[model samples]
Target: MSTLEIKDLYASVETKEGRKQILKGANLTVRSGETHAIMGPNGSGKSTLAYTLAGHPKYFVDSGEALLDGEDLLKMTADERAKAGLFLAMQYPVEVPGVSMTNFLRTAKTEIDGKAPAIRTWTKELQDAMTNLRMDKKFASRSVNEGFSGGEKKRAEVLQLELLKPKFAVMDETDSGLDVDALRIVSDGVNRAKENTGLGIMLITHYTRILKYIKPDIVHVFAGGQFVKTGGPELADELEENGYDEYLPEGSKESALA
Candidate 1:
């Protein structure tokens, strides 16, 4: 099985004031077919960890090694990371106004695989994936995530996850803004990807509701820019009942509760 290891990761982002450190010596390991849930309060740097691993330009790695099967992910470019079997489902998926979903998916698939798929087979696979995600056929011809509803955008992200078949996926709050039915559908799509490909996952979120569907094998409490607690599924139930107050600092507790 493949392994993604994050070793003493330190990262930061620039703001008007200055560079603000986010991830401070964060470390974790995820094996193929295992799901790790990262739960934290807002501004706790959970999303920062997700974007940093995906190699987003806005975040800079200060000192760390994100090794995917012994290869350093911090050394690769963003697209290079993807080619190396890493995927990020953004918290807010961006809009690509002129690109058709059909063309985008095929082009991305071709790039990742290093060869274009046969048209007939690729077309069938795309249709089947979309259908399984409960997406409309018309979405294939529409601009990628342009003018789509929140749920539709999320479904489109899962569509890419299913089609691209990444080794590990950092899903950043994918359960956010989803209704009950949509949540179940999206969760099912994720489950299917894991089952089909043994895809490892780092699922970042604030609530345990998504955990009910995704079922994380490990749950981590992120605070003070790093993981403070790690446990099994029972930890999520505990967080749900008690909230992050115990995990937060004195100054941060009120805001977290509010």
Candidate 2:
């Protein structure tokens, strides 16, 4: 079991104005065996929080600390952070032209585990996880995310989640482009991961349909760079029904969190 703590986090992206703040004094905490959901409208800095926690070079943390199991994550590089058991499933997965799925997984496994497992043993586990995610076996030979469908791409992300067994995972809009069937499969995959591994998850999404499939212990409403409300799963249903209007003033969404 592990814990991820983000305290008074202030972050921004490099821009002509020097740094454009995206996350402003945000605070969150997640412990093992719990699933937390963050829901907000567009440009709410949800993805920025994910990238910042994962230590992406493009996103800068101007203030605050991100701790993984009591270790200072801000002091580590991206690969070091991953090795420390932090994983982020990107909203838009990148395609590597020449990286085979099988080989990439093996390399990442080697790096994280500090040694290589027997080929048969590791490959068997990989195949099993892929099967659980309902992915085709042929993808093992294909380049990573190369021309795959949206559902296929999301499944590939979940495959890594299972294979890596990270202490905590930050999923940024993972259900964005998926259709209904794909959404069910993806959410089911998340449920399986939570049940089977006792992993802690922070799911960042804009839709409530997924909350039905993966019931989160806590639901947070993020807007204008910070969280304004935190509630149980019922808040998700309310948001879905009211469409964030009750939470907003006339002709104004910019002040929703301010």
Candidate 3:
């Protein structure tokens, strides 16, 4: 079974001063067919962890291990990690000015699968996914994310999820900058993608709005650059009721950063 195991991950960004550690000894294990939520404040290393796990070159894993189905992800290049079935949906999805969505998807599919999908079948699959995502078929011919609204960009990320169908994915703040309708549509897309692919999802967000739609099997609270508390769905409610202040001392949090 495809799974992700992150053990005591300590990561930092390279700087002139020294390694500015962001994630501190965070541990998480996600098995196949499960959804996990990671919630935290700004600069709490939520996105940092996701980027690092996806093998982003900017951040360095000072100490710890991130394994994908028993393969050492820390040792792989960015493309190697993607080919190994790891995916990341960023908070700020980029826009390509010229590449059509169809072209990009075809290239990614060919690379990931190492074989060309039959044109007839691939087109049908793409259209079907677009329809399910409430997207216009015209988008298939447009440049990737060039003029997409926040909602459209988020939806495009979900579209890739449906098409690529990676074994594991880490969605960084996917719920950010979305309206209620957009949130519901994107959440529905995620649910459908999971059902269709059985992809293990690690959803990162600060708000519980998305959780209302897709119930997570586990909810983890990240603070001070590490996961501080974990619980069921009710924990999200508790955090919503009372913020991270109650979970961490003001002084300890401030000192931890210094």
Candidate 4:
């Protein structure tokens, strides 16, 4: 079984004000086929952990380790991390102006697998995955996420997740900007991926609505950079009834970008 292990992680980012720390001693262990929900207030280090794990250059890992299976992930570059079966679904998916989704997905799969997939099989598989996500067939010819709506961009992210079949996925606020229907569709896609591939997921979100659709095996409450509490799905219900207020202090609700 595959496992993603985070150990005493400390990360920081550069700002106009200078360096500011985000993740501090955050640790969690996720094995394949498990869904872990990370819930916290705005300034908690959830997204930072997601980007840090994906080897984003802006987030510097000051100390500690993130391991995939048994390999060190922090030492790998972004592409290297992808090839090692680590995937990140950003809260805001970026637009690739020139590249069509077809070319990009094919190339990515080729790069990760070290060879191109069979054309006939890949084409059918892509069509099926898109259909399952309720995406238009014409989307294949368009540039990746170009001119797409918020929900569309998010569905595109899940489309990649379904096709790429990564060992571990860090989904950062995937529920953001999604409506009720879109949220359910995206959540279903994620659940399907987890069931089909035994993919371990780190679902980061500020609200618990997404949790209703994609039930979490473990719920972690993040505060002041690291997790302050960890529990079962019941924890999410508690947060939903109350709020992050009881868990976080008054001035601790700053934006996570700090």
Candidate 5:
């Protein structure tokens, strides 16, 4: 099985004041077919870790190695990282106003696979995936995520995840803007991808709702830019009731509660 390993990762972001550190020696490993949930309070560096691994330009890795099957992900470009079998489902998926969803998905698939998918087979696959997600046929012709509702945008993200078939996915708050029915649809898509391809997942979120559907094998409490506690699914139940207060420092606990 493939493995994605994050070793002592430290990362930062640029702000008006200056470059501020966000990830201070974070580490985790996700193997194929395993789901790891990263739960944390706001500004605890959860998203920073996600973006850092995805090779987002805004976050810089200070000293660390994000190795995907022994290859250093920190050295690859964002697209390169994707080609290497990593995917990021952003909390806020951006719109591509002029790119048709059909074209974008096929083009990305070609690039990642180093060959074009047969037109007839690809078309059928695309149609089936969208149908499974309960997306309307018109979305295929629409510009990627443009004019779509929040739930639609999230479904579109999952559409890419299913089509692209990445080895590992860092899903950043995928359940954010979804209602119960929409949440189930999106969660089912994630579960399908995992079952079909043995896709590893690093699911980052603040609540336990999605965990009920996605069912993480391990739960990690991220605080102070590093993992402070690790447990099974029961940990999520505990966090849901207690919140991050117990996990935060004496000073940060007050702000987290507020």
Candidate 6:
């Protein structure tokens, strides 16, 4: 089975004040078919871990190792990482004004697969995925995310996840800004991916509402830039009831916000 493993990962970003460390020796492992929920308050470095794994240029990895089925993910460029079966569904998807959704999705699939999908099959697959996400067929002609609503943008993200069929996905607060119906639609798509492909998931979020829709196999409490606790799905219910108060030290609640 495939595995994405992180060991003592420490990363930083350059700001006006110079380099600021975010992830501090965080570690985790996700095997295919497992969903790991990363729950924390704001600024606790959940996004940092996701971006770092996907090889985002903004973050600098000072130390640690991330391996995807025995391959070094840190050594690969962002596109290379995608080719290696890693996917990141960003919280805020960017708008590509000139790129049609159809072209973008096909191009991405072709690049990652090292081959162009047959026109008929690919077209049918694309339409099927969009329909499953409740997206309009006309969206295929529109420029990516341009003039799209928040729910539409997130649905597009899941569409990519479904069509591309990545080995593992890092969903960074994908539930944010989604209405109840949109949330269920997106969560259903995620569940379908996991069931169909045995796709491993690193789901980053703050609330447990999404947990009800997409049950996690494991729950991790992220705080102070690292995972302070790990447990089964019950941990999520506990967090929902108690919040992060018991995990955060006195006067350190701010650290949980990430």
Model 4 Cα lDDT, one tens digit per residue, 139-194 = 99999999999999999999999999999999999999999999999999999999
**What TM-score does prediction 6 earn?**
0.97
User: Compared with the true structure, what per-residue lDDT tens digits does model 5 show for residues 182-235?
Assistant: 999999999999999999999999999999899999999999999999999999
The CA lDDT at 139 in model 3 is 95
Candidate 2, residues 54-157, lDDT tens digits: the string is 98888988889889989999999999999998899999999998999999999999999999978999989999988888899999999999999888999999
**Alpha carbon lDDT of each predicted model:** 0.96, 0.88, 0.90, 0.93, 0.95, 0.95
Ranking by lDDT: 1, 5, 6, 4, 3, 2
RMSD for all candidates, in order, please: 1.1, 2.5, 2.4, 2.5, 1.0, 2.0
Model 3 lDDT on a 0 to 1 scale:
0.90
TM-score of each: 0.98, 0.94, 0.94, 0.96, 0.98, 0.97
Off by over 4 Å in 5: 256-258
Q: After superposition, how far is residue 116 of candidate 2 from its true place, in Å?
A: 0.7
- Name the better of 1 and 2 by TM-score: 1
Q: What lDDT tens digits, residue by residue, belong to model 3 across residues 1-258?
A: 788999999999888998799988999999878999998777788989999998888899889999998999999999889999998998999999899999999999999999989999999999998988899999999999999999899999999988998988899999888999889988998898788778899999888999998889999999877889999989988888887775566885687668
What TM-score would you give candidate 2 relative to the actual structure? 0.94
Lowest lDDT 10-mer window, candidate 6?
A: 249-258
Which prediction has more favorable lDDT, 4 or 6? 6
The numbered model that scores best in lDDT is 1
Off by over 4 Å in 1: 254-258
Candidate 6 Cα lDDT to native: 0.95
